[model samples]
Target chain A: MDAAAHDTHDAHDEPHLTPYSVYVGIWLALIALTGVTVLASVVDMKHQAIFVALFVATAKSTLVVLYFMHIAFENRVFWWFLLSAIATFVIFVLLTFADYAYR
Target chain B: MSSDTAMPDLPETNYINAEKGLKSWLTTIDHKRIALMYLIAIGGFFVVAMGLGFMMRLELLNPGEQFLDGAAYNRVLTLHGVIMIFLFIIPSIPAVFGNFCLPIMLGANDVSFPRLNLASWYFYIAGAIVALFSVAAGGVDTGWTFYVPYSANTDANVMLPMFAAFLLGWSSILTGLNFIVTTHRLRAPGMGWRQMPLFVWGIYATSWIAVLATPVIGITLVLVLIERYMGIGIFNATMGGDPILFQHLFWIYSHPAVYVMVLPAMAVVSEIVPVFSQKRIFGYRFIAMSSIAIAAIGSLVWAHHMFTSGMADEGRIIFSFLTFFVSVPSAVKVFNWLATMYKGSIKVDPPMLFAFAFIFLFSIGGFTGLLQGALSVDIHLHDTAFIVAHFHYTMFGGTGVMFFGAMYYWWPKMFGRMYNRTMAYVGFAMFFVGFNTLYFPLFIAGLKGMPRRYADYLPEYHSYHALSTVGSWIMVTGILILFANLIWAIKRGKRAERNPWGGATLEWAVASPPATHQFDGPPEVGEPYDYKIPHLGDDESAGSGADEGKA
Candidate 1:
């Protein structure tokens, strides 16, 4: 509770810099995920194809949030904030499916 | 703490007079200025929405259509809900009071993203225009939820209002993001998380709900629009989509939205209850943590709304259980508030009166909600007048009542003028009585099986409807007096003291109506509710010689 406890924030005076190559790498992964999504749609996995496409889209978004949004370089509290959003989403999806699955 | 001299009669340059014209207000990034702008916008919409409610009550006076026909009544109902929920209640406490007070309470000059704060106001205005324009271009009749199948079929201008709801969600998300950053970044030097004010905690939890839950509804509305526009059939049963999915998505965002509406009001109670009682809060951490518990637990109970929509028993029971569980945190709050008042020096001032009213009324609302949460009871009261009555008890009785309370509590500090406390008490009395008279009857009628959303009721229900209509007249008269008294006090009331309420928080430390910059030095952080000894002392920075605990 002292001022010293807050004196050491992870977000210091200097910005956490990411190299250009890391951005290039994330861009390549995004392109590969897009191809996977399109390919999954054309293939006849039927019901699971939607899941496959969704899975790929989720990966793309994770990459964007962690890197493009710089959450990877941010403080621990930032992760807690992200986790809360994910928790809300997971609760909604799971509970919603509980109804649909039971039906 | 030095208390030799009293502070100045009034600050020569406060936020209000610091600048001089229309454009300064229009273009300003100051959180206080933005809050005032939101107050005007939200207040204007509230009156229009109230007028819509008045018309509905007028139409329902004797049943069988007083003036509005069945179709017209449907349109009027939809408009009222749309304006009240989207344009009014959703942003009422947070955007206005939260904006004006949070940064100062945290000992910062402004919100973290001041420009974004201004943008949220503009977004509110834009969405409001679209909603009002929808009314002119042949109003929507989907009844605020915009339930599908029928929503897709309705020829009413659903698209425009739906678009407006989407834009309002953006406004909410941006505001939430701004608040989260502010809370993380801007606490005064020594204040820790536990030492922060309960109002800040309330707003913090609400902001997360806004950020996380709103996007689902935004996309859900968009899908419906696309379904209607392009025959996408996502929610249209004939087109191989599930209408229940639409319900799932709608309430998923909406049920938490109920908390988005009420949590800040609860936070306001946590604040005023202690100051008026002349005691420190009973259990600060418990109250602070319960706000989050309510937010998280409240999010999971969305399916209770869908229980009678023909969902399976497993989902029904689970949602029912969650619904019952959510009330625990709220009950924790109510009990904590009661305990805070015990053996303390209690002042039945207007704000405390409103706080008392909030506890009594919201508890009734909460218990009734638990009644409906029981799967068996819900099967009977699913869409009855009881549901309508329960919602108002919580939203109107809880949030709307506290809105006036906040106006009374902070009026002097915000406007640099003290209102006539006697008139305020009179207004609160009429409002409380008229309020109970108006909505309390519908609970009985609902129990007696009068249906909701209908233009006519059975002859047996006539007495209930009549009494309720008369109650609306009483309530609106009380509301008129309440607003008139406050509005008149802006220029004419007594010049207020900087610390009239002896609050332990930071907002009272500066000049009444406060300077454009809040603190002249690092605000000394203490436990927010502590009132045993003086919480603050005379520093030129703290409006020289204005000491807390003087009252």
Candidate 2:
């Protein structure tokens, strides 16, 4: 197989080409999520507002990765790798925080 | 020009002869050529850094400074650390050998992005140049770590070196990106993950660490630069910034950066041991997985470096535990390597000797590392000569020795010439003896409470310091001889066979000093370490494949 065919095979067993409308929809969803984050910030959610804002931001980025980046259609290995990267980052942050908090 | 007409016989040109002139090399996108460029550049830096180390050892020969004063000694120490860490060890195995061999090992024509590979080399040179400029314009003495307020307030050319470090980090990240993509996409047909060479697996693990961890240091250095010029208080203690934060950020990358240096060395050992032992690698999957394990667990153990840096008790305890845990994967590798060598047809070639030495020296390094991992022990050993000795044992004995062994192993393949075996053996013996002599005493001195990075020491420490200095001279002599043998071999030695070591790998299938394009067609993937199925260079008896392959 050529490069394109090989890529399709590795990415999705059967290539699934999403419609242009789906991309547009994902873009709109990301925008909506951003707006939600902004709204959460403006409202007096107090300490929970930070969590809400983070949730919306995470949701927005997920939408971007899954749909816009075509990771949704990509192989499962990609998701595992992404998760590992995030986990490693979170571990670093948490460990650093552990030092700072106790100190 | 008829369709059936045989193509005209082109000149038989490998990458070295594929083009002519300095311009060809400068603009060349060929991974092999770029690897050669890096070998030369990185080799030069190694020599300079080695000289700096030699001078430091000379300075330490007596109780007081032999040549350099305190201030001068600090500058030399800083430059040596910076150059060795950034220019020599970090990029030595991966950028040089990885670029040269990864593509060929994968049976691909070149890396996924050839232009990007070339760009990374340029970035490396640019970084080196900036660093050298820093040296010329009054060197920075904040050390390679560039910790906190000293880095911020220093009158030395700190900004340039920091910028240089930033560029080097980018170079590292880009190389990682290119290798990761190449590994994922460019494997030969029928070569699955298991079929991939252990070296590729090693590079794969190292690349991920480089990609994820390097950016932290890049940003940290930028923060330092910002604080220096703009008076930003990111890590400045007086200005409410915590200095420990800098240690956290630096070691986050720099600790994993240890694997980035040594994993490829381990990968080289993984390749050499099986080939020379005349057996398939024992526990191939375990060895492969351990590389990944090292990368992952290695990243989490960065705080171990900050054990004595005033981190909280909880932090020290957690970090010490994690640090001890990281050693498990490394021990797994060491045991597996020993098993691979057990009762096998071990050829005591230069490469195998180095591999054996790596196991020994790296074990010493690892055990000492474990000693330092204990919170209480680390408080005693931290900032001492013992830590210095331990790091050298790990970095120099592990990666640096392996780097030379790789040069010996791949010299024939890379340059198509065989080096003098007598000289190689002599050099290896001297190097091994000199290495132990140089560092072992430092370990003892360190435990005796001799602090490191000092221009002078007390009368009681003089004997150990003298012995260490003598060992440094012997080690340098061995290094010189090794380089001389290889350099002479490149031009004057006997011609080399394609499969000099008689192992099974895709690179060995191709010509020694391979053709510009490594493979004419997709390579036939086989068990990478299948020694029972005799390789091309083996005799007919070995070729008969009567012996059952040992796993």
Candidate 3:
């Protein structure tokens, strides 16, 4: 039962060159985002600053997850696994807000 | 060819069976051996905790100046809760059955990282030793929750045990990570997600929660310890730290922690229900999804625990409704388990008996939980035995009963031996009867205004307290018998076939006490659970060979 025997149709074998520049650009963008987040947190923006900081953090994490973790290039099955975690986070944070909002 | 005759001869017993001794147990790295060690360690701790419970009951038995000081009783009760929650119940099902079964169920030789698995056991043991030191040194009376200013302010030796708990949580997170990675990467080639047995799903869900939420508790405990020792500015309010922040952080992990405790029990029930009923689960997808839903919803409901802890009125209202919402998924599971049994061929094995008990007891627990979620009701039942009784019914009756059932249910598969069925039934009866007697009265006493964690209670609650103590003894007796039965079965019982319960899961397709490499060949990837699938008896289908390498 050689598993590779069943892998004649490999998904990663698609013709696509994700270039070195793509990685360099992503790193630069991430560094810029972190600077913005830190600057935003310092301004007396109050609760708005907190949300901005979280949003920026989320963006940075997304970039890391997609490129560094290679989740973006992974299979649909892997996406399903990753999305489940995202969905759980959404539910946790939103449902909490639902309480906060209603109250 | 004469090659067969020239083949190297090996010893009769290799590393696994050679020279059985205490040394073999302590230093050995075999997952089964490590799991057995965990079983013994946690079992001993369970006894110690229950003994503490007995002492509490005795003090309550006579009410005033019965056996120990007010502080001593408080300390013992706190230690009992902490030990049972952290040391015993949380790890009981997962570490024991999960370690033993995960590889077998995946049709793999071992966990993806067996050394990590072994390291977890060592971490567990070290944590246990520290916990015992805390207990011996007059114990910390902060309750298992270790609520804010009190925990930080307590002079009783606190930092060491809090550190122990913090380390234990990391150990739990590592174990969770190990399981998640193994279950994902190590399944046999043809084993798909849908093809996985429900117990695996249960563990997978539990692992996810363990990985994500345990960090919060780990940090919380660290903060608490730092506050206690170095006078840190985290949870302590005098240093501009909000005590409410402590409650928030604690429940963030503690609430999800209940799911960690209960999901595996639910998973065990899912596996047992189908086998005992001789039916495929009514809706496998629903059951599996509900586990994920419960884990997700469970994390958000932590605020409900703090409804009366002086959060804003808005926070209270929001948490109250979210609490009810979390109950929806839990109720879905309860209904699904019951529906799985409807019109199916139900067997009355001890495992099923306990699953039935879980359904009843967890329902009581869940409903009582909803009662507490009501801000009005919680204001009254805040520190009462009702809350204590509610959790016991859930954690003890729900998780503990399911754990025992799972042990009996999977014992044959685990040890390749059959336990004495009559003894199993007797143990189940005593446990169920004694369990209801013990906790049900607490619910009554609680509602009638008996606060929990008290060394002395009003005279009116005296008779019920005595009855409860008697009930605890009966429950303890049942556990002793249950332990004996399993031990005897392991050494002396009749050998088991591959699928004693006729389960269609991948685990049952392998050998009883599966070989080092689990599958004879590739997993027979058929329907995971389909009552309609035709079955051949074990004897006729037992000729699969091991040499054919799996992909």
Candidate 4:
């Protein structure tokens, strides 16, 4: 297979934006998200805080996955995988709450 | 006209020249070579651990401290778990098949990180050496789980082996990352997500779990080491830290860890099921998605393992429900496999035979796990032999059986040689019979109120323990026969055809022991298990599914 076939289908290869812009944007976003996570940790939201911090982290991770990892423009499998992973995390949280609350 | 019809008369693959000595094996980054390394390493550790197992069994032969005292027994048992779980099962699938087939299946020349791939082998060896050092250094008596307080206080060789394990986890994480990136960035043209083979899906799912969950263990282990070496109070109950918190952090990584061990095996089954059935996998999208689902959900249910470890009552209930939720995707995969087999011309090759065994054994393992999932049931059976039996059935019976089966299934394409099928069949029978003999009696021993991790037992449990010990010998003998068969085949086996089993995946489309660059051109993107196409060389007709086998 022509290795060049990959460049044509890459999501970021569109003419509207240069590759430089994409890279810069992704780096900035990652930095901002890391800052947010650190800031959220310092504030004492008590029991509600862990979820808050995780939510922000998850959002940042999504950006990284979508752009940096290139899953956003890739096949439906990546999206399904990310969604499934998040859904499982939700289920875990819900179950933990149920166990702690009921018993 | 086929653009890539002529087979390249490549140099003899390392496989055909199996006796080129250490240099050929070391310099080679072929997946098969790496797989052999894994086979040797895991086999060596299995023997050492099995010896420890026999000593434990011998001590319980007639009960009451016959062979070794409690302290020695505990230390040896801890060493046994450390070796078997970390050294054997955790790396079983990913190292073996993922090393051998991942790049080839994707039609890439090699893994995206080939040097790191070889590095993982070195790290594995290093880890094993460190593990041996720990064993020789008075041995760690803390269970493999290493529940805090005691782990921190114990004078056993905790730091070395635990550090080795931490490095092993890092190696696993890197491999997972490699596979994820490779699968995403490296597939041949036309091998879209829907068209990608299931083994890739299994690895893809497992990679995600490894990347996300492994680091938590890294952090947790650091905390343990800190408490042990630096006298920090992270998990020290006497120092005002909760010991159960360690369990919390531990299972967070450990529980999902079982999936890291098993998902690739599931992937192996997915590949095997469709091939032998002579049918396209039923619900290809669902099966693929379910693997990812299982990976994600599997990680979340780790808390369930800590239920009897003195978590809050509410925590136990929550963990139980999450455990049930996690089972959904696994059940989905099982149902799809059954559906794939329905009304199909299912051939019972050795690999298919093992797939059938995986379904039966894993199902037993899965169902028995539910008993522990229930809050009341676990309280009674938490530390019993029932839990031990259940764990083995899932891991040993589930992944272990599938691992052997996968080796048999992919042996030809990976090694370019076929094993003696009759010997293969005999090996399977011995393993199957011996496995039951070994573990089923443990189930009996478990139900009779026999607790785990103990070297000696009451006289009443003596006969059963003796039976179990004898059965273990049978199991060991079966494994020995398997290795012997594989070794003989490597030396004197018949040359394999490219599509020896009539398998339809891209890996089968290449020459046996494919060239340094795995494929000459883009692989034919097609129905993964299709075998009846008019011209198998034509990529366009490959995925059309029109000529799929008729039942």
Worst 10 residues of 1 chain B by lDDT: B542-551
* Candidate 3 lDDT by residue in tens digits, B1-551: 01112222222332235448888777766666667777788888888998888788777777688879988877888889889999998889889888877766676667777788878888888888898898778788888878889888878877777777887887788889888988899887788888888888899899999988888788888888777778778877788787877887787888899999999999989888988898878788888889989987788888887767667787788778878998887888788888889999998877788889889988999899989989999999988989889999999988888878888888876666778888888887888888888888999999999998888888999877888888888887888889899999878777665466777776676545544455555665666666444442342343221321221
For model 3 the interface RMSD, in Å, equals 3.4
- Point out where model 3 deviates above 4 Å: A1-103, B1-30, B531-536, B539-551
lDDT of 4 by residue, B1-551 (tens): 11123433322543435447888778777656777788788878877887887777767777777869989989888888898888888888898788778877777767888778878888888888887888778888998888878888877768887887888887788788789889988987877888788999999989888887787788888899988888878888788777877877788788888998889889999999988888888988998999888987777677777777766776776668878888888898899999999998898888899999999999989998988899888787888888888999999898888888888888766665678878888888888888887787778788789998887778788777888778777787887787777778766767655565667776776655655555555655666667674444333322111121110
Docking class of 2: medium
Model 4 root-mean-square deviation: 6.7
Per-residue CA lDDT of model 1 for B268-346, tens digit only, reads 9999999999888988889999999999999899989987898989999999999999998999999888898999899
TM-score of chain A of each: 0.85, 0.74, 0.75, 0.62
- As a TM-score, model 3 comes out at 0.86
Q: Which portions of model 2 show Cα errors greater than 4 Å?
A: A1-81, B1-11, B538-551
- Ranking of all candidate structures by their DockQ, best first: 1, 2, 4, 3
Interface RMSD of each: 0.7, 0.9, 3.4, 3.4
**Which lDDT tens digits does candidate 2 get at residues B1-551?**
01122222222566678789999999998898999999999999999999999999999999976889999999999999999999999999999999999998887889999999999999999999999999889997888888887888878879898899989999999999999999999998888999999999999999999999999999999898888888878898888788899999999999999999999999999999988988889999999999999999999999999887888889889989999999998998888888998988899989999999999999999999999998888889999999999999999999999999899999877876788889999999999999999999999999999999899999999999999999998999999999999999887877666667887887776665766776767767788888544445432221111120110
RMSD to native for every prediction? 3.5, 6.2, 5.9, 6.7
Off by over 4 Å in 1: A1-21, B1-8, B533-551
What TM-score, computed on C-alpha atoms, does each candidate reach? 0.94, 0.90, 0.86, 0.83
How does chain B score by TM in each prediction? 0.96, 0.95, 0.93, 0.92
Task: Name the runs in model 4 displaced over 4 angstroms.
Answer: A1-103, B1-11, B14-24, B27-32, B534-551
Native-vs-model 4 lDDT?
Answer: 0.78
